[model samples]
Target chain A: MISRRNWIRYSGAGVAASFIPTSHASQGRVVVIGGGFAGASVARELRRLNNALSVSLIEANAIYTACPLSNMVVGGHRKISQQQFSYAALSADGVNVIHQPAVDVDPERHLVTLRDGNTLNYEKLILAPGIDLDWQALQGYDKTAAELLPHAWKAGPQTTLLRDQLRSMREGGLVVMSVPKSPYRCPPGPYERASLIAGYLKQNNPRAKVLILDSKDSFSKKPLFLSAWQSLYGDIIEWQGESDGATVTAVNAENRTVSTDFETVQADVANIIPPQKAGKIAHLAGVTDRSGWCPIEPVTFSSTLQPDVHVIGDAAIANAMPKSAFAANAQAKLCAVQVTRLLNGESPVHGKLINTCYSLVAPDYGISVAGVYQPGEKIWTEIDGAGGVSPADASRETRAVEAAYAQRWFDNLTTQVFA
Target chain B: MIRTINRRNWLAGAGTLATLTVQPRLLAAVSEPVQSVLKRDFPTAEIQPGRVNIELPALAENGNSVRMKISVDSPMTPTDYVSFIQIIAQANPLPDVARFDLSHANGLAEVETRIRVSAEQDIVVVAGLSDGSLWSGSAHIVVTVAACLDALY
Candidate 1:
């Protein structure tokens, strides 16, 4: 006669006794900031784990445009609608989903202030505020300049803006993309974007050339990407790594010119991805370290500076885990479990974590890197003899299979987190 | 052991298990090739499936470089130790990935490495014990493409 939900709860009790809420345990309130993959997943997971606890999710946008597949939109392979999701499902799942920008947070008082001047109280605050572009990091690059030269890193209007610029440029024109240094979100994203853009130009404007000015000496999946570039796009795509004097210091939006350490190149379209840091809310809460990212206890994801507040996703400095959506989702679930255990007056336990990053060289060509990590004494460490990149001499069929699986992964992840 | 059980149960309850629907064709496509390779390589050894453990991701972001760890539950003494382990990717063009030879001096019956997976298929690990018995284990992995292009800026 038990309902499905109760049946699951009862059946799981024998194995996860610590997770089951006791009658004496008081109902607590948890407030989450930034409803991206990390925030949304934690909110829903908390609700699923214990319905008695009150959960509220604060997100700036009503519709989230995912960043994982946005490059395809820029390359004209997919529509922006496919990359967007609504929060109705999370709300229906008993989370108090608020469509408001959280402007500030007071860690001592455990309060979050929204843009419209209202404050929400919580016993525990979870911050999944992702990252923000550091406009001042690069000279001549600011909010206003972004309109002319779009970064398109956030995946909404900027994604379409960059797409429009690429579509309208004259045939045989130059497309310049500037990449920031390491510790940025998605280590292999820029290379994948460059590859997809070149794929587009190869079919539409056969004579056009795409130039990548990278700040790092090397990148993820380099050998696999380089081989694909050679066999597929050949002369259409060019990459200049850090040693090639490709560190961008400034950009003249009016002239469509990007200046590196040694030279200034004028282009028909300029895509500048600047250095980044934790979202503003994390800084206002005083949880972020001097590195511009939040430092947390590796086991519980609790902020080192503010133990009552936890940070996940790209905003937190998760040792050895790259800032990708997959990593964010994985961290969110682990963090949720710890938060639940802490609320129930139990100590947090370590969990196994894994991250797999996939990048598309062409629509049918794909590559990836996988790593299994564990919480170490002070930081997270990659398990020795586990995780690696794809082999260099794989056949064409392998690439095609990986490409299809990439789409499937996107669909599955978005559905699980935000559907 | 309790913590590991909790993690597995939570993972199942978290909706990840719902996305894992094995395609029958994928299994059918690899069974013959895998059996043929096993018979051709281990001509005299009889393979069983109990002691070996193959650890791998259920859904791989990239097939090109998937990491795998293999261990067999055997005491590493001169009288009773694991001798060698062979890895095979059922659907790969070149199915034989690697083979690691071991001895009592090695102290453990475990090996870890990164490998290339050509498709969504089973990765089989077979261990040869000094007692002339072979133990086998396999993990079904779904190797997908990368999703880095959509990173939040």
Candidate 2:
């Protein structure tokens, strides 16, 4: 973990270096699209590893709202500002951070075109565009419908909208959440959201209910979540898996209802997490596969279909590795190391990769899953006898400790990647 | 060198190989719980550090079902083959995870199955050969608390 003192020290250097022009005579240029955990980490690490290399990070938003702890904001336990981060620290670290949307990519010419009709050239390109919700996958759920039924998946204004809706809802009203199938970002996120929302309603609106409609029969950390619901929230939170005909086929945004083959249920407020695909920039770069995600070579994370282009984070199809911030940070570091080696005319070897995902069942209750992975012949293989979840019968003290650790992890990770 | 030996040559050379025994190098390195389990299971045999390989995730997402694969470097011929394999999770409420019996008719000395790991602990796999010598391999797994939430924003 990086200390705040170290971050301040780097910021001091950035202040002094900002006056002088960056040297461009050493290494080739690297252009990274997207400024989330993956892209931001790679850009900063590249500058740290080889200061001579010119690195430019393109992101559409000026302030990034994190998805990790946004559930707290939705549950009215935390403020949205707490989840917001700026790129100023990264800019101070000698990274050329650009606040603009990337509209097109010409891989043949190694050029990325911004929305303002400006283009950036690069020797190597890294894409960490994350996931874009599939609007067409669910009928009657488009950008306009999102205004009525907030997904809150991106953790910004949508998060506030959902929170406000819950606050104004009637005491006996039902808040419905629809979850997509497997391979979506944050496999266990909807449940965590449900848990936190239920906790909020249990205190403020005692009679309100939170219903989860899942497209899949099972979810990550199922037993722990179920036990938490049973012990903490009781019947305030109810779940219907795919086998129970809870798969949402369409959304009637006007009536605030979702329809499955079995029935159509109206809700006071609907949160729809639609199906997803690689972000637009990834698709423009021609790196995504039929699965609508980028397939990368296990060792270096380069695109299997395109040369000199690498994809990381949720945009990449990482076997056995869930789409989480921890996994993205791990992948970004490895990608940075490999990209450096390749630029120096050396072969890239596999490195130690691990992921730790922590979820908050309540304000003081937390759980996590961790795994160590190795690059196999074609994909990543989870190392045997190494990783598992928390014990079923853990004490309250254990849960509290994990909750503290989760906060520390968020602080350390955000500082490492963005600050 | 073993990879180049033919099946017929391996059978013919079994008589000389049967007398060779590997040093018990892992005996001093294992934890106390693992040592106790090993001592109870193979009191008379020297548990050596070769021939057996245990493949499991270094970290697991769930402790309820963890996939484990164990393979032994044996000819599996009538003359020299693996007889049985025993698995033990030193920290589990029940130390014994599972046990598998094998024979020459099985063709290969490999077993794949899933086991529940209660916590972070060292899992040991012991293979008993037809010659009465025991070979072992072990892996340490960390069972973390699982939340599985993605921070992609």
Candidate 3:
């Protein structure tokens, strides 16, 4: 059922059909690197869409912990166990699930080298490795400091670490969270984290304070988040936008202090979410740009730096779409579809993409932003009025419903990926 | 347990301290059992795994967006139609993903939607018959890569 329209167009008398790539022949090896939202979705969709294609998913960890709703974990609304998942389902479905770190990729030879000193060849390679924290952005914040001042931007041990620090601090102590510049994973995540932490401190330590030291002038869903902070948390939380000269210049993780141009502030606990770049694997594969992110063709997700290599998820520069799980999943399915057609010698057909992200300001309060995106002349663009954040003036009941919807969305999205 | 916080000054100047492991008691404070909402709601209802169908992919690449279609084999007549339906992801942070209220007007007991899963888990669907009996169906999804669990280091 694979289309061969491109073959006919490229050559007369159907002679191009013989030259069709048997190396990437149907039922050939399709290796997917990184088992995050983007990689996993592409691998599964590839297999489901074409059973003949042998799909192998390479992941480093045996178990996965989700970042979405991890704020709730910090707020004590949920536990980390609730977010953990295994690879049993994907393995049962015939996708070869390999738990190993892929060390390098030789695009020229179509070979992938693993940390175990082994190699695997593939006809097509899909890289969905997520983002990496850029330590250079903040002085004195490195791997060692991350242990003391956890970013918790990734959902794992760091999350628990941050939660524990908040729990152990003095009831009336100050908790400072620093936000970096844009083009990072989960644009609205830091604000959501701030709100949830405030919600936690509000209940347990009513006298406690939360300070948001931001590097950016503004943030995703700024108006809605700020409005919620004012009406819900009030004096307990203080946000210093970039306009206030809140750009953090240095950090003393051990002392829980962050220094901005204006002043150095000490805190009981500090969470410094660092600037990010494409995960290390993307750079190793030589698919990244000067921006430290992989650039890809909008329709195919094919890396501009390498042939037959596609990048998705937080690592790729998807113009209109924020680096989010939902966006990554959407991009993955499109990549799978296009990659399949390309394997079958057909021209790729682009389609509409959608992303919706929900952030909880309180246990029963929520807000969301959604958009339908399509390819533009140069990059991706959101359809007008198709995507926007939840209204600032939404009622309490409406917010509660949105909260329920957010949980439901999380469940549904997770089931779509893992169950 | 309290030492980590008070040692900030000492630790800051030292640059690094290897002894600051998180206290197990702290993680235990938030740890709880994964309890299913359906079992709580229908305590007396014996959910038999039959007469219901859950259509989903056997393998999910990304647990963020899995397509699922659930249906019950029902007569759909006023006397024999299904009353309500619930889809649950047993391992999700929130197990009660979605619930549907159906009536005889639907003419059929069916639903289709996309779901997110954090890991490899069961997608369970329970349908309440008009007689108050609950029939269920479930599909096992293998997720090579998880969704929601972000910040892949």
* Model 2 interface DockQ: 0.03
C-alpha displacement of A382 in model 1, angstroms? 0.9
Candidate 3: tens digits of C-alpha lDDT, residues A1-419 = 54321221111122222322345433456789998888888888987888767777889898888888999999899999988888777776667777878999999988888766566677789999999999886799999999999999889999999999999989799999999766689989999999999999999999999999987555778888888998999988899976687878799977789998789999899999998889999999999865578878888889988999999999987766788988999999999999889988899987999999999999899999888888764456677666777887789998999899989988987787788
Runs in model 1 lying further than 4 Å from the true structure:
A1-26, B1-153
Which candidate wins on TM-score?
2
- Candidate number with greatest lDDT: 2
Taking all chains together, each candidate's TM-score versus the true structure is 0.70, 0.70, 0.69
What's the TM-score of candidate 1 when only chain A is evaluated?
A: 0.93
> Comparing 2 and 3 by TM-score, which wins?
2
What digit string (tens of lDDT, one per residue) describes model 1 on residues A166-264?
999998999999998656888889989999999999999989999999875557888788889999999898999766878787999999999997999
How does residue A271 of candidate 3 score in lDDT?
Answer: 91
* Candidate 3 segments whose C-alpha is farther than 4 A from its true place: A1-27, B1-153
Each candidate's interface RMSD, rounded to one decimal?
Answer: 15.1, 14.5, 18.2
Model 1 quality (TM-score): 0.70
Quality class of the docking in candidate 1, CAPRI style: incorrect
- Could you tell me how far off, in angstroms, the CA of residue A176 lies in candidate 1 after the best superposition? 0.5
TM-score, second chain, candidate 1 = 0.74
